[model samples]
Target: MASPQIIADTEYLPTLLKLLDRAEKTIDIMEYSFAIGSATGRLNRNSAPFEIADKLIEIKESLGKKIRIRLYIEGYRETASRNMVTAEYLKEHGIEVVYGATHAKGFCIDNKFLLFGSTNLTQQSILKNHETNLLLNDKKAIAGFNKYFEFHWKGGGHGGVILPPPMIADGVFKDVLVDMIDRAEKSLNFSIYFFHISEIEKAFIRAHKRKVKITGLIHHHDAFALSYVRRTRGTAERMNDAGIKDLHYGPGTLFTHSKFLVMDNKEVMLGTGNWLHEDVEVHPQLYIHLKDPTLATNLTKHLQKTLRTVKRHRKEYTDSISI
Candidate 1:
């Protein structure tokens, strides 16, 4: 196992399962959603064992009081999931499970190990998308993440009903951008799939207009609906003309899905949501704002790798064009 590792999409599942087998004392899992294996068959053909609810029940039954487990996932009734049944099963088996407004994805093991990233431990996320996660044994980091988890868990962060942040109010997206751009003092680095709302683009344009350097890595795929493509193209042009350097295409197993914004050398934002209007409107999302240079630097290195990969892939296609 690589310490301070960077594993691609398909690589994390085996490691995750190995870790689960080794877990002894306790397991705390939080994710946006935790559907049963059957539910995932609708998306694709992979078993959703990582949901952990059923496994927790088995663990309790086998260990007979040696191991403990707790689960928390978003409680959305709009979707058909075995979440409530899983929770009830775990409870009946002496394991703790709660569902509400969770927007975080990660698991804490024995209160000593931490796994956090842009993955939900779900079937599609684990098998399909380009995702990233970190497994850290650092005590301080685990303590910090666990503290934040407890704060939200106690505050009913599991509620199904979402109260949209005021449409006009400055939101977490803007707050993250402003912090990154301010400290960037020199350059801002960003990579995202969509830039539909001016709220996000305005921050970049503002940075460019103020003479702060800006660089971006954007997806080239046109998978969005026609209406969305028109708006995103407009934003792309604005970004290009605003003196923002861009890496237009990204390469990976699937289209580029990671969302990251790093400003200057200081602040960073990474999450599951795009910098788009629907992200703030209908889609439930979560973004983490941090001042961790180590993470920011590593993410920058990944972006550099993406640029190289995209260049190589593009050249292969251009060279093969029939003359």
Candidate 2:
């Protein structure tokens, strides 16, 4: 069993490519968001979106029946245009494309290797977003993740039992987060994309009242940036006003798309979904929690590093990262 590897930001693309290159039997991609060309933001000819898509096509064309490549994408109307294009393009190249209201982002290769977390398969996500992903080959973790994916893939298993720890789904997201916040004794470090969830905000306030040190990094937004940032700022700023003044906005150049919480440097809840709302039942969502001190410390250090970058840069962080 190989230890889990933590991959972040620009490093995600190369690591993903390497994994796909090495995959022999299967490549299962369960992504929440995906787009290419103009939709992925400004990019030169050498774009991650194209590179990854081409790799999938090449694998299918070269290996043929020996390789089974399947891609699951979320089909929200906002991204329907580009996503439909991508889905049709991949289908033309011999890849199985399925669409649903997916909010899970993960990759399973040969039933052995797994890459799961906040990063999306997009140009902006690859080139600009400050994303965090975990790579693992452990059979236990792989089995659990596969079951989680299958449950959602099979229409919630016709109401089968949700898998055990490490894989959280739907309403369980809040329960895990609130429990962690309630248990915190020292600190809560957050780096989230959307963050208007009131109950989670209240939970943080309660934790702060308990003298738990709180620090956060939210992507700053103004009138632009697709109303997502604009809508989420109320709760984020409310948290800042409620005595958690350390909620600093991240660099405008990068979308802080990671959803993670490090509690007292002892545990981490990191995954794809944002803190946009408490109504987890609104979307089929998934997250993973780990109680490893080492992982927690590593992520805490990552947040501290991001805070340093946030302080040094100033290009009117109010501008949209979509540019």
Candidate 3:
């Protein structure tokens, strides 16, 4: 396997399962909307989480106390209920699971492989949603991620904060993202969901006005999600009016859920959480910065693929969710 590989779109679940099957000693996972087989109580044998649970069990037969899987959902309503049931099922299988506002998403397997990104552990995130995740097996990346996973795992009930190790414990993910955006030297290619965070938007505008080539996709403004139009509409108008015309939104509602920024096609910052101000203050978000050109290039390709499905204006974005 390559040291750094970009796993995007529908490639996430299969890659995850392959890693689980190959686990030699340890497997640690932290997901926001968790689900697994024998937990849905609907005999969901075909769900992505089902296959994930099945694979974990297959490995657990050999490495009992060594494999650790932790999933804490930050979702609401049905998602919360689903996470509880899944957590119980995993516990019965000797895997530790809990619930909280743990919005981080990643997988660290056997100290060699680490996958972190904007996708959750639910069926929709794995099998359907257009997500961005990076897989790293390089020594430094793997070591850092191992520290990152242990940092969260040790947090126990609260699912830890998203700062990762060696970073200041009091730091927040929004600052990290804003700082990265503020320092943009050349360009940014992004595919993000929920654009309600004004500070990040302001930093983005600053970069754009400085002649940074900013382009990316957003979830269509007309989705059925709560206040969906309001969130995306303001963002779209602000960017468009600022002369950032390379923006596109749509490919339906679900496909644009990627939250990632590739800086100059050299570094990638990706993981869970929307850019909503209220959520940023309360939720445990994960945003990692890696200076890997190969990963950034792959993420850019992922963002550009949807340009064919998105429209530039508000009146044309086809809503995937019916009102």
Best by TM-score: 2
Scored by Cα lDDT, where does model 2 land? 0.78
| Model 1 lDDT-worst window of ten | 161-170
Which stretches of model 3 miss by more than 4 angstroms?
1-3, 36-40, 65-78, 138-148, 151-171, 221-223, 309-323
What would the TM-scores of all predictions be?
0.72, 0.90, 0.83
- List candidate 2 stretches off by more than 4 Å: 1-3, 38-45, 157-161, 223-227, 315-323
Residue runs of model 1 more than 4 Å from their true location after superposition: 1-8, 35-62, 77-95, 137-144, 151-173, 209-213, 219-233, 251-253, 277-287, 315-323
Q: What is the C-alpha lDDT of each candidate?
A: 0.60, 0.78, 0.68
User: Which lDDT value does model 1 have at 6?
Assistant: 46
lDDT ranking, best first: 2, 3, 1
* Total backbone clashes of candidate 2, pairs 3 or more residues apart or in separate chains: 0
Expressed as tens digits, the lDDT of each residue in 95-201 for candidate 1 is 77666655567778888676766676556667766566666675655665666466556753322222232111113555556556655667677667666777667
Considering lDDT, which of the candidate structures 1 and 3 is the better prediction for this target?
Answer: 3
lDDT of 1 at 119: 70
The local lDDT score (0 to 100) that residue 184 gets in candidate 1 is: 60
Separate clash counts for every candidate? 6, 0, 1
